[model samples]
Target: MPPSADPTVSVTLAEIARIAGVGRAAVSNWRRRHDSFPAPVGGTDTSPQFALSQVEEWLRRQGKLDEVGSRERLWPEFEALGDRDAMGRAIAVAGARLARLTDKEAGPDDSAGWLPGGTDLSDAQRSLVERAVGLAKKHGARDTFDFLLGRWLDTHVRQINVTPSPLAALMAEVAELSRGGEAGDVGTVLDPACGTGGLLLAAARQWAGTADVPASGAPLRLLGQDVDATQAALAAVRLLLAGRSPERESAWGVDVRAGNTLRADPHPDVRADVVLCNPPFNERDWGYEELATDARWTYGLPPRTEPELAWTQHALSRLAPGGTAVLLLPPGVASRRAGRRVRAGLLRSGVLRAVVALPPGSAPPHSVALHLWVLRAPAEGGTDAGAGVLLVDAADVQQEPSGGTQRAGRAAIDWPLLHRRVVSAVQELRTIQTTQTGQAPQTAQTTPAAPAGNADGDRPADHAVVPVIDLLDEEVDLTPARHVPKKATSANLGLRRSWNRFGTLLHELRDLTATLSALELSGEEPAGQGTVTVGDLLRAGALTMRAGQQPADGVVRTGDAPDDAVRVLTVADVLAGGRSSGWLTAPDASAGENAGGLTLTAPGEVVVVGAHRAFGAWVETDAPTVLGSQLYALRADPALLDPWFLAGCLRAPANARQAGTHASTSSRIDVRRLQVLRLPLDEQRRYGEAFRRLTAFERSLREAGTIGGKLVDGLTDGIAAGRLPGNRP
Candidate 1:
């Protein structure tokens, strides 16, 4: 008799395939070929379930177990625990055990018996607690718990809420920067809506070993409040693991309360030295009616849709004099009409300092890029504030490729570069502050160098110092792009470079046009060809279409690979003329694993964007890359179809229109329904060649236009600055 399957913890065949790092077809083949394969533990015929432990044993015997990580192995067990509330409770309990162990207040033999509330734990829950303890021992309590929480959030991302680590790091760094040169002077940090305590943990870590924070002295006071009791408990456990003693009384001030921060203020009168937060965005009913009369709204009352502005006010209200608060907010908050009045108020009072635009995929709800607002609590009589507001556009700062497999749609931040840029901008603001206060320059070059009689002077790349008076308008748009100064083109070398580039582009454009004309004149028009749907070609084995959604692990927005990771080709990359720019990284074997539902791109394959604004390109590069979200990879049989010809037909305007007819409200195209012109192989070769030339022509035209625009701007600036001779025939 074969081994019995464990009914408690089972996974579908698709999950098994994902675990084994193989295709679904391969898993199906394995089931049919191996008699020793795990039998169906549950589910219907179409979706058979196998015991997770049995599948692991089988995969281990076949040497495929190495593909699965410990986190991946634990996920099935976590899911088997049932619902979100149960999962949250189990996690909170496990966190309590880890916290006690970390604080040395519990013995090695201790269990969840010491957990607060004295909730009864089941056998399964106990097992989970033991596993959590093991993980904490191996990976440290903070990292282990953070990983668990991240995975839990990923499993039910729509329902379970938490801040991404990168964004949290950014907010923390901004808080530290807001402290000016005396960053070590910060003794207290607070997060009002501290979900999973990510922002608070980041703040604590930032101030851990500074000179001001003596090792023998009391720990820095960390305060947080959350609506969810379990999340608040988890936050407390996380803070305790970060060196705060459990026995430390409220007199020392380490509070992590479980309550609504908006309605009920835990530390209403206590002002923190630094407040770092990624507050909940786009909440409709955030107690607007009750909080309308609240004193926290020093700025104008935030409208119903602008709950983020209310959180902003709350953070500012909790800040000590001259203390800075960094908040991550949706970009819409910066320019929304409803929040315009509040924005103007913040600007006028010098409470709003800097707004940094981060790249997309920096945090969850990853579709749009978010903004970081650095605000400082104004001093008495507003004497310490600077006259100029600093705006840093570090949006383009990302990791560059370090020779590895790059994944598509993953936004990997270059932390070192970003840190330097943001810090430099803050230093500039500090310089402005010093200058405004009539203080002597500490350094000979303390003042920003400016051209004679030019208020819009030469500034650091991606940095702008906009006057506060200029920001007060009806729109009150605080977007960095609106304020940052353009690059100076007054130098002779700059003008010469622009001219050279324009000339080169013009030459290339002429050559491309000639080549296109020659190709068009040489090729004879073949007899009118019949049209065929892509579905017909797929059914006839002429092509195989594989469409993949964005991976669930995380979206990579940067185009740089760390080491052995593969570079991903995103839809943005495809639309940008199929260049390898803006590529993101994934592990080398991740393409094979398809762990995040990522599909690998192969040479000779034609890739198509299946979403709005349809586009297709042939995979000309041999470099390893994956098909990004809303993209389809079509591998054609060379004997039956030409790769270039297939790509050209798919990208043709006629076929695009046909595909658009089948599009849904979101304008997502079904590539299989696209109509393509069918012709003989010989005739297709001619048309394919012409299409290739046409692509080159279009690229050349774009290059020429870009160069021409730059040339005009350079000339205009040079003439205005009196650097270049303006006389012309």
Candidate 2:
């Protein structure tokens, strides 16, 4: 039976855009220009929600529901539950329903205890599950579940601490290369802190493509454990769906449990051939005191400040004899004083075979370049290869330019090139260890030679391999940049590029100054009517204000977002005079009834940031955006007030000081108290043009100053490094 109308189901503007196959701006325009559009049923003024039933009916009338399939229709209903745990339970129920299609004996409760009361589903939620099963019948279970899982992951990205696809693939590839054998050679793989089975899936894909199999044709074993029971259940269901696909010729032995691996390990007796992990970084309370006397600390007792070291040791302890484990850790663990002894012991024991430094933006906390440590369980009697460790510095490699209006300094990793470079370096080191094991070890006193260039000659060398002895100094520093030698040619080219950019910015600055000087102004003061307060204008229906409120922790995602996500404008963006640098997605925060809601600003709206040091007001000319905290969006009635003129009045120094609620510099401005001068529409336009021109001039000045600083820094560094011609410091 078709599900009846459920008024409780609600969706945000972003979700509406997805349903109608349109941009978020399109939905905002529909709300503004179409009188018949649905009014907000719930949510705050800043972010309003609409009933899903009404939105669907409206879309059907407009012929937009013709192409939206079952998957799209079911998502908003699942999200409307307004709780992540509830959403996860819905997914588990859906998975169980799909499983029944393959096995008549399997009941609705056959999710293997993935969710408590697994068979329990509300009528609305159960109806959504049936739609998911219908989607699976047509598109196959794997693809259907994958789409739902992908959306869920994207929504709760920060909380889950997902390992991005590129980095996961890179780690899997490195693990395969380290094995020095066929892809299917590894018998067992485990991820202790696995969140939604990203690494385990990567490992499965690595082995799935190969022709090799054991004599018995037994499937590879995949094991995982996570702290969150819901995530663990989702991970298990994800693996089951992937393994049960008809196209797959072989299956996998999947076992994912929920528990704190450091405190009470569920798989203490089992050792795996390969362990790939991106453990939680900077965790202070990871069973430090309880597990202090635990035997996993083979190298040394980990300090409280160095939780990554503890995870590193745990990964090592879980490896089978002659097995390999690859772990992603913060760069601080390589050289921090607290973990120095542990690092030295690993190097001396020869179990730490190599350390590869990945570029920033490869994973979470994108500001720091993370490192990958490759270790192998020792043979009996702890026989060391004594061939010195391989330190690969791939941090400075070329990167793909960041998409959207992200800041210029932020760039994404070129995954293919980086994977090839690091993998090839590791293979070369393995070859050396195999061929020269018995010979006396050679001491490497200085930085190793630069890597060889590619045969294509288009890409320069970016990684260097360093020896272990040189790394075991008084500080025992393992930072890749400290060991990798920079190419003189690259430095010179960078200096040349900076000089060219400096010249271009100077020309632009001159043009801006000329434009500002040419603007004519009256020499005498003109007569004006008394000013009107912003509150008065709002009460008179001449303007509408949406005050910015603090959003949920996961509302704003930094760095990159999905293609459908909208950019969020923050107070920092206003103060810096730049494009939006944050992202907004459809995720349910604690905003009840208005979960996943968003308010998008129009082109002519005024954006005001009232925080004392961050005070500023400007007319938004870019695409629609959600205002971040401390911001206010004012959309004026065009017939009454000009947006640019209103923005200028609010931004005046005296007006801001008068509106400030406190006598401190950091006090916030009460935007309602700000005054706007009363003027005729024609006269407002005249002043608006002047304000717009001055605003452009100030923005250009800031850009010019930034470029000038870059130019000076480049020149200074070039001279210091002796990269400039005929120059000495």
Candidate 3:
């Protein structure tokens, strides 16, 4: 086996086969047969290393994880909490001695508690590890807890089983990369809803086994308190593994199952430098009635319908001034009016910074696009740097159709690309802050945005801060789209009349150009110059590419491929820029070739990128091609026109601005905005020559960006649109 010392960001297939005890060929066969097997993530030579998130998902699908011990199996001597209420029973059963169970030695009877049937964890602190796994399912949130507990028990428990070393290392490197207060400085890292030890471990690893933040006096402070003792114990195991021994590192604490994040108090006096969490979404009740007089609900009583608002407030409460948090939230949080008060409250409170969309299906079974709401507390004596929220809709990833349907059933989350986007967005946010506000980042300005007109026919108000307290007075629609103001767009972008006229004119122009090209090719004088549509270019041997087609059952990507990535070639990746930027891998070879054919992209080929907004734009490249189907890959006849020139013309201003904007689907993109007109050949060559280096530089910039492994586009968007992917938004 290869050593785990290499610091690359991806996993390999060979390692996957080894872990599953299947040959690489068998792995391939499995991928082909099982529609749900995750595709190859950041590839490694010896073993395929998947994003740790996806790895757990794979195990779940295979039913390989050990279910928690049955009540009878939990302990032979203890009585089952049969008639008692779940929460009350959980508290009674989990109290006191559960912490000491970590010391129990692994044995034949105890072995059953550790692994799934025969699959025990001698590698991990088996007894303790197994308890954490079941504790989450019994006491914590479902999906998130499953991943956290599963990974801790099955993967990271023992030194030998503690694999996927790349993710932990990469996370540390990423945190180091985001260094603001000098290296090795440690304050406290807080996770409000600490279900299992995963995030804390990630944070502990990031802090490099020590806490030494610049301003803080205490060096090693990692504070986390969860509502479940099993979770706390699980976190304890991880903290210990990362060198936070029980007796030695008592300065910081991890409390599990102490109290509700909303109602109870655990670590009420502590403040954190960084707060990271994936809080539960859209809960109907969070005990606002009991906490009616509580301090955390500062603005107003949280609506009985809004758990999201409560979580947001709780996160803000724990956040120290100038501290930053990356909160994973439901998409509706951005557009819902029911949560409007919280939305406006957060925006005006100098806490909200950036809202980014992740790819579809990043969360399994749920296809809504998830958003990362990056927030920060106001800094002392600094100007609030807040202005417009950085609204980035990057949910445009190449997705295979999930059958002509949107549901993925029981597939793993698309964590790789979503992770990449998180890394990219975080890097972008930090870079922007560091560059715009200097190393000592300024406190962003806080001002309530204008109140949105009520969807229920409430009188419209002029621009002003709408009190968060009053948001629940009406039908709650907390969606940002419902109230978040849209920058006025030209009629050309969203209006219908403009679309019709543009379409008619474009068709006439294309047909005319085609006629003129045929006449000129026949040596008959027709129009000003002989012209060929991208479609015509493909017929000639000099140019070739494919178009997109619908996906098979249980896939979540769209686009073409350059035969080698072994996908059905499609036109979706083809932009007006004439370059197929992304390619979709076939979930299985039997799905058939896309665009009705297979084609190869040898180096020096030209490709046209087509999307809902940008239609006629072009690009040329020697980059690897899995020719994405939305695009038209063009291999030009170099004798007549240079390949670079054609690709450059697609981006020319004089050309159509909206290329390939015909798509009506929300998950699949509308490329009309990128379309450009066909410029003169000489002009194309001149522009191409001038901008080639610039394009190369842009490509280099994206290439150099880090990967967080979470899919932001389809994964984030699919889940957020309030329906499964393929469902209309």
Tens digits of per-residue lDDT for model 3 on 1-729? Answer: 111211222334433444454455665577669878775565332234454335445755697433443221222111122211222222222322233333332234332232111222232133333453455344432232333334334322221112123333333344443435644454777777765555566666566445222222344466666655445545553453344323443324443334566777577877777766666666567686787777886545567777766777777678677676666677877666566666666655656666656545443113566665666667767535443344444454323323111221222233344345445534554555556643433322122232375221121111112223333344433333333332222111223333444454455545545544454234564466454555445555645554434443333232212233432234443222223223334322222331123343456765544443434433533344344445555566666566676666555544443333334652233332333235565776765665565455443333223111122332344356444546664
Predicted model with the maximum TM-score: 2
lDDT-sorted candidate list, best first: 2, 1, 3
Error of 3 at 698 (Å): 36
lDDT, residue 706, model 1: 66
Supply candidate 2's per-residue lDDT for 323.
81
Please provide TM-scores, in order, for all candidate models, with all chains considered together: 0.72, 0.75, 0.41
lDDT of 2 by residue, 1-729 (tens): 234347888777767877777766678778889888899999766568898889988888787776435567678877877788778767777875665555343355444455423446677667777678777877667677778878887777767788887788889888887767776578889999998888998887776533232223568888999888777777877876666643443368788888888899878987898999999999999988889899999999999999999988999899988788899999999889988999988887878887888887778887678999988888667656547776777876555322212432233456677777687677776666767847655432232344575333123334444566777888888776777665555555666765666676677768877877887777865665778999999999999998765555666766545545556767777666555557665332222113334456679999888787888888987645766678888999999998889999899999988999886757999999999989999989988887887887776566667667877876777677765565655
lDDT (CA) per prediction: 0.69, 0.74, 0.45
lDDT at residue 522 of model 2 (Cα atoms): 79
What's model 2's lDDT at 339?
88
Q: How close is candidate 2 to the true structure, as a TM-score?
A: 0.75
Best by lDDT: 2
Query: If both were scored by lDDT, which would come out higher, candidate 1 or candidate 3?
Result: 1
